[model samples]
Target: MTTPLLGCDFSSAPTRRKPIVLALGTADRGRVRLERLEKLESLAAFAAWLAEPRPWVGGFDFPFGLPRELVEHLGWPTQWRECMRHYAGLTRPQIRETFAAYCDARPPGGKFAHRRFDKLAGSSPSMKWVNPPVAYMLHAGVPLLLEAGVHLPGLHAGDPARVALEAYPGLLARECIAQRSYKADDKARQTPERLIARKDILHALEQGSTRLGLRLKLTHAQHEALVHDASGDSLDAVLCLMQAAWAAQHGAPSYGLPADLDPLEGWIVSA
Candidate 1:
């Protein structure tokens, strides 16, 4: 049986404007070959996809958990399962209100609490987006991952075939560009320079100029398709693809699942 490779651009509310795009590929001799891209616009569609059985590995661009401190501070359950149950039960307004109150009590920088993962892995809260825009991504992505029942490597082991790892495009981008801005959804900042920078970044990845030792070989058409997407959606998805590629290289069962992920502390990328 051929193992299908998957990369996802997830959204909390996956609609036409913000759908979950899954890229399927295969690995051969350490190279990942792109085969297809699938987009699901609703939770129902995604649920169907998740229910299917397949030997696959995927990198999903979303946070798996919030800081343990944040959960504890709110008097919420510290265990991942209980926390997710409690969080899923609350309305969006209630979640925002609770988080907002936490922020109000703490100083500006101390708003979102941190965890051991934050310090070790160097990631922000899933709710923080100003600096990296990941806050919006977390808000848009995590819930759906939960609903789909995909196995979150360190947090929850839902499915063995359907493996999910937390991946950040910036981690790959910075490796090639070193602090250069590549994309901006904001029209004002989508300057020619930024576009060119994005192109260059894409080119670098295509040439395998990173630590993963894997080159992202895209056709000219595919290159154009990735470069022209100003919102960075396609690019971000491909970034995840590379992470999946790296995970595949390790010959491990799954990329980020540790032998022992804390049932209460939750999982982050095992960087």
Candidate 2:
């Protein structure tokens, strides 16, 4: 039997308004099926979920580490574990102030430092604590993975059955629709145009048209749920879920990450 795969749309401060979304499924022969999509109502709930020992791979939508440039500039530890330890100890305000100072010292268009993987994956700078607040996401999420002793491929090898990968739904979403918005957290901002974009993305995934060569098999209810979720959390979870499926298909030595990946700055899966 194939072990399950999961995709998480994480939030630093999860509440009923912006809960973490989890897509649970199984993959077979390049096809992935959706079993359920679970919404974790709080960060505590998310931590509890990871405590269960399970055989599964998950693509978590959060940066696993800071850029090497940022780490070195701060004179933090160069090792991944030590760097994470130092980073996790800081308050959010301290992080913001430090990052802002770092950015302010740099020239325009290069204010924020980047990891090699961020450029390849077309992801936002991991240090940005606002907008997406991914810095806080890392602050909130990475510790949980570390505590659970989950395998992080190149970064920190642990349980093979419970692999954790950095994933960005935007990388895969751009495969179908470039520069088009698909989700909005605010109910009023969920527009019809974005709804159409979501459908287009779903159609592409179902047809196995992307580079991954995997088709998504969703039940009628599942399809409707993905479409009706104007926040795009469900679809984003599905995208990460497919990434996990693709990684599993290859028996990914580095979980579909490049061989030359930086252990300090973790790579995004299938980027």
Candidate 3:
């Protein structure tokens, strides 16, 4: 049987206007087909979705763990689950204050402590609290994945059938578009150029031209929907879906993760 795959574009705080988007699909051979898109307007909804009993391998666009240097420096727990649990107990303001202090102690151009995988993936430091607020994303999302009993490879052991891998869409996006901004959260900045960039990305995926070597099979309407959604939430979800497909193709235990992947600082799939 072809295992179902999910690519999630997450939000720490989701509402009707900017909900979490999940691209649902499956992979066979080297082809990934877009089965549908699901939106959750709240974390509770997302949690419920995760709790569903099914077999799936998901590529999640959120940091699954923090940098070991930052964690150790902060005197936090070193074990992956213990560290995350300790992190989950803190308020957002407390997290912000603590992380801010850590940054303040560092010199210019070297503020944020990063996971080793961050350098390879070109991802924002998981400790970042502003701009993208990926720190909060790790706090809000990872605990839910843990509570949902999903397996997070190279991090914590859980259900084998329901696997989750850390994923960054920008890694794939940069390969196709090379630093072109293809998305804008602010409606005023959603330019025609960005739309064209999105089109180009979709074209590249459909042709199986990206380094992951997976073809994206999207319906005409799905292609149009992804291109027109200026926020790029749907497109990001699809990007993650393709990554999940790639991971699934590898099959079983590691699911394309590096043998040396840090248990406390989970690696991104295909990074």
State TM-scores per candidate.
0.86, 0.98, 0.99
Clashing pairs in 1: 11-140, 12-140, 128-135
Q: Is candidate 1 or candidate 3 better by lDDT?
A: 3
- Kindly report which residue pairs in candidate 3 clash with one another: none
Give the poorly placed runs of model 2, Cα more than 4 Å off.
none
Worst 10 residues of 2 by lDDT: 248-257
lDDT of 3 by residue, 60-141 (tens): 9999999999999999999999999999999999999999999999999999999997878989999999889999999999
lDDT of candidate 2 over 23-139, digit per residue (tens): 999998888999999999988899889878888899999999999999998999999999999989999999999999999999999999999977777899999988889999999
Q: Once model 1 is optimally superposed onto the true structure by TM-score, how far is the C-alpha of residue 44 displaced, in angstroms?
A: 3.0
Full-model lDDT, candidate 3? 0.95
Give the CA lDDT, 0 to 100, for residue 82 in model 1.
73
The TM-score obtained by model 1 is 0.86
Clashes of each: 3, 0, 0
Looking at model 1, residue 77 earns an lDDT score of: 87
Model 1 per-residue lDDT tens digits across residues 158-243: 76767777776777777777778888768888888878878988877777788777777677787887778777777878878878
- What candidate 3 gets wrong by more than 4 Å, as runs, is none
Q: Candidate 2, residue 148: CA error in Å? A: 1.0
Better of 1 and 2 by lDDT: 2
Give the candidates in order of TM-score, highest first. Answer: 3, 2, 1
